[model samples]
Target: MGLTAGVLAIDAGNSKTDVAVVAPDGTVLATARGEGFRPPAVGLDTAMAALAATVARALAAAGAPAVAHVSACLANADLPVEEQQLTEALETRGTTVEVRNDTFAVLRAGVTEPRGVAVVCGAGINCVGMHPDGRTARFPALGRISGDWGGGWALAEEALWYAARAQDGRGAPTALARALPAHFGLPDMPALIEALHLRRVPSSRRHELTPVLFATAADGDPVARAIVDRQADEVVTMATVALTRLGLLDERTPVLLGGSVLAAGHPRLVDRVRALLADRAPRAVPRIVTAAPVLGAALLGLDRLAAPPESHHRLRAHFGT
Candidate 1:
């Protein structure tokens, strides 16, 4: 029999790392998950070790003899320099590895068409695009600095800031004062502040507040509604930037919406963003992404193993199911 071909795919996010082994025919052979890989939080050694452990588990489960190709989609791998470092890191493991920003994998996961935009609002926000003419554009996505907002972390931070200001009589009072404490099992704002100061509540867990913010917004809390509205606007702005840069604003672009924030189905947030995009690019329509990013990473690995046109059908077929 001919040698069995296998690909290793990885999605390293702010809170967790997911790995999968895929057959050449696009079947997911096995999968594994581990802790987060954000360099600022986990350090390079721990991050790489986590990724390796997850991949090894996946390969073992799949009974794959060798990893013919690898693709890693990472949250902080935005800049080319960072991608280079990630590639070197993966190469050290003796695999033919391709590293790219997580947003790129998200876009690939959501779109089979030649040109489209993807926005992800998980721990942080990011947007990317690929045009039919082989052009691509991605936002800096460096959080507040890049004016990229709207994500679990951003919502949580905004909720806490608004709640604290309200407690100090500096901002409008909202349901968040009660909602945040109820959500976290804290008796009062002072207790919540103390817990945060003591690191009793880890940063990743702050994403828990995102739902509370959404709830308050739905309940007619003006401050919460304003925060959600602003976040929606920011997401739209990021998508617009990517579309304009890729010159795809005029096309029937598939705008993929991923991440927990958008997945919550907040009508205000989703409808407002849709309206904003419609105003600028009437062809833009939101596509709900159902495929996991790990699959996207695998598709990227498959892309490296075969020409784009050759793999397009297989990629779409695998994800479409």
Candidate 2:
């Protein structure tokens, strides 16, 4: 084991990328944040360039001559081919790199031990689990296809669809029609539609209306409540699939929830998901994870080094808790 060894960890999410450099002892030497690496938001060339820039900045701040290893946990990296592409891109910067889906990193960061299920609902939704004996399964996150639903994008789309329906009197009346336009300072639904058509309103920014959906549901809007309830059910379904695949559905299995939607602390959504999970998987209990994803990426980097026992202990003590 090299006492002076350093690791570079990168967590590339849908909305942002976070990079960190850490010593063998787990003390973070430096950190940097950059734009999203997912396609459409950032092309392969731009994403690699941004990764290099962030890594260079962190290394300079850490005063490290070079990093010995890199572990990147990225969104949209579920397939082996995607992982290979991302790993190749990072290796061009001159370090041995390992790549895995972002949810694995979240699971590592949130789970005290190594075996359990993790459900992430950020801009997109995914569920993943790893067993103690190396078995693994990941639920497909087909993004609006395969009847998949959940995540910020799902919520936003639901809200907009409801608002448009309510405007046309084809759906149950809801406050979303009023509230959504107010979000953009538009006086009515027609103007909101016009703004969307004119490209005055960006698709990503439409996610901001998700909160209004929850609020409308709270205030007894039938359409909004239906959307929220359906989303909660979808999340529970994803979590259940992961638990089942891991054989953790029997009893005493722990499931951790992470991502923007779950972390938002929406009581109704939380309660609905808890109810659904309990009904479907009687033995599973969902836990809250407050650990940052960067820590998970760092743990993966350390694991790759096959660091000494004492080094692992020190790293976890410094960053895991």
Candidate 3:
């Protein structure tokens, strides 16, 4: 296919979708964002259509007819069956289609090398690793039931739990007792608790409290600091297990961190992650991905086209850090 034919790249997360069109030489042709995919809730057809809307917009923006390939990194595509299902669905929209978990997007975005591990801490947490020999390691990442911990929602919930307990004298005193309710403009913990239980404040808004927890930790709130510490521990624990599983513990492995929680560069989190990784996996180098993961999807498209390193450079430069 010619460069003008281009490749369609899609990064579909639980909360949003980003689509891009890139030529064979890594020139970004078009980019668009749209609603998230909800395959489990709305079925595969609806989910694919949601993603296709963005793809169409990108194609229109670039004035391209049909892409030569499609590289998609999607959220909720945990199982092989799910990936295959999505791959089949996406192939209908393009000539050639590839689909993988969104964490792979983060992994590829941060590590230029083929071998590395990536942990994403957004609304939820997930870890995945790749070996140069084509081996891979990944967690199920189905949230609490899957033995996962330390994401924005988890952090906010931890803060609320501690604050509620502290209010009833079941836990140690902390600023969260006041800060958590105050964040919602409530008078006291009781009001905050009541509103949360009644859905007056809505549990979905719980994620909004994550920044409050981080800010309180920054001010030396012991309980909030403890949550941050646990988050750091979880990040390192996931990375350690992934690196060990892939047998990259002794190798100079790149440990890539992504998503809003880790990407925020909070000292309380990053500093502790650095310290823990130094002790546990001394050879692992931690790096926070500054680029959007859609770039990773685009790069995968270029890779499928067998574009060279210079093409990768041009894509990165066009996408920016």
Model 2 residue 290 lDDT score = 64
Q: Please say which candidate is ahead in TM-score: 1 or 2.
A: 2
- Backbone clash pairs for candidate 2 read none
lDDT of 1 at 26: 69
Q: Which window of ten consecutive residues has the lowest lDDT sum in model 2?
A: 1-10
lDDT of 1 by residue, 198-228 (tens): 9897765788999989999999999999999
Q: What is the lDDT of candidate 1?
A: 0.81
Whole-model Cα lDDT of every candidate shown, in order: 0.81, 0.80, 0.89
Candidate 3 ranges with C-alpha deviation above 4 Å: 1-4
Clashing pairs in 3: none
Candidate of highest TM-score: 3
Clashes of 3: 0
Clash counts for the predictions, in order:
0, 0, 0
Local lDDT at 7 for model 3: 76
Write the number of the candidate with greater TM-score, choosing between 2 and 3: 3
| Model 3 TM-score, all chains together | 0.95
Model 1, residue 199: C-alpha shift (Å) = 4.0
